[model samples]
Target: MRLLVMLTCLLAGCLAEKPHPCESPPLLTGALTVSTQNEKLWTYTRFMYDALGQRIRLMELGTYENKSFSHDVLALFREATMYEISYHNRTCKKKPLKTDFQPLAIPKDATLLGQAVLGSSSGPGQGLLVNTWTGDLPGKAGKYMNTVTEFGCIPIATSYQTSEFGWAVTSFFNNVIGIEDPGLLNPPDFCPDAEMMDSKVEPIDFLSLFHGKA
Candidate 1:
């Protein structure tokens, strides 16, 4: 279950947009692509955000050996809650999950790779930032090399390679930011057994994000 949470966070984080002040709001929606060296393992993701810069929805659809599965996540940041509905073997179970919606800080050891224009389906911008770092991934032994890219202070891409794994995983965010539909913020009725999971994460000041240049 925690693995699923981390996956969603990494996928969604790669597409995170600069946090906006409460007075001025914006919405973001886009598809996320996750791929690895071995073609057999991959995922297709879609995520949505509300005006407050909170992630409202994230869905991951995957196909393996001609079979498919999905993970649907719905979040209520104001209520400090998260829901995860997972599908496997044609069955789905909804569980309460824990998370901090606040932006994750870049590790101090990460080396800035200089800023440049990152052109992609997510749009081209001159201020896109990139950094390289080495760190231990969750639930994985040893350290890995990671490269992170950001636009408007929000991460737009992340890639990592580890010697032990013999493969690299890369995630990309397709830029699609605009006004979001209010109805999409609500959780789907299909997931009825959502329960809260215990966690000790703390929230950060969202407005202060992007204060310094990358």
Candidate 2:
């Protein structure tokens, strides 16, 4: 387990995201949309948020199916965190959830976006390669966890495997570490969720890495 986590840390930068100010404050008190069938596209969803703007309650209406016999679904996931204050937070806490399909789309240019993966440690903990992620996936227990991006794959935490997110010590941002086959390229739109920045496209602020603080 010790060596495995170390490997994930090494690959952290490739899949990690750098913290930037949100375009606008989160609509904490808003409706969240979800699809019914596959998580890749149009997830079925129809649920209500609690008074505290937390997803404490749920009501599952069937997917917008061909108006056939409708069914009710319940929310199994919980809203742990909303926004972030700084890179001090965020790290991968969620365990690996395996899927059979390999990620279809891999970024040609991996240096275009954020630098840290899920659950990346704060800048202080980051070595020459580490980065701070913020306002992203709310890890379990409201804590941050290093995340695995589409291009970068998630590593399995086996006692026998190598350390870090599964790359050589020199693999930061060069080539992917754990990802085997890049998954879907043109995935079905999964509602209005925050789209993970595609690794192929560069953000205008890409140069901010060398610029003064925002």
List model 2 lDDT by residue over 44-92, tens digit each: 2222222222121122233222332222211112222111111123221
Off by over 4 Å in 1: 1-27, 37-40, 50-56, 64-66, 75-92, 98-105, 115-151, 161-168, 189-214
lDDT of 1 at 127: 50
TM-score of each: 0.50, 0.18
Q: For residues 63-120, write the lDDT of model 1, one tens digit per residue.
A: 5434565656566666655555444432333333334563333554444444445444
Q: Model 1 reaches what TM-score against the true structure?
A: 0.50
User: Against the true structure, candidate 1 has what lDDT?
Assistant: 0.50
lDDT of each: 0.50, 0.24
Range of the 10 consecutive residues with the lowest summed lDDT in candidate 2: 205-214
| Worst ten in a row by lDDT for model 1 | 205-214
Residue runs of model 2 more than 4 Å from their true location after superposition:
1-29, 36-44, 50-55, 64-214
Best by lDDT: 1
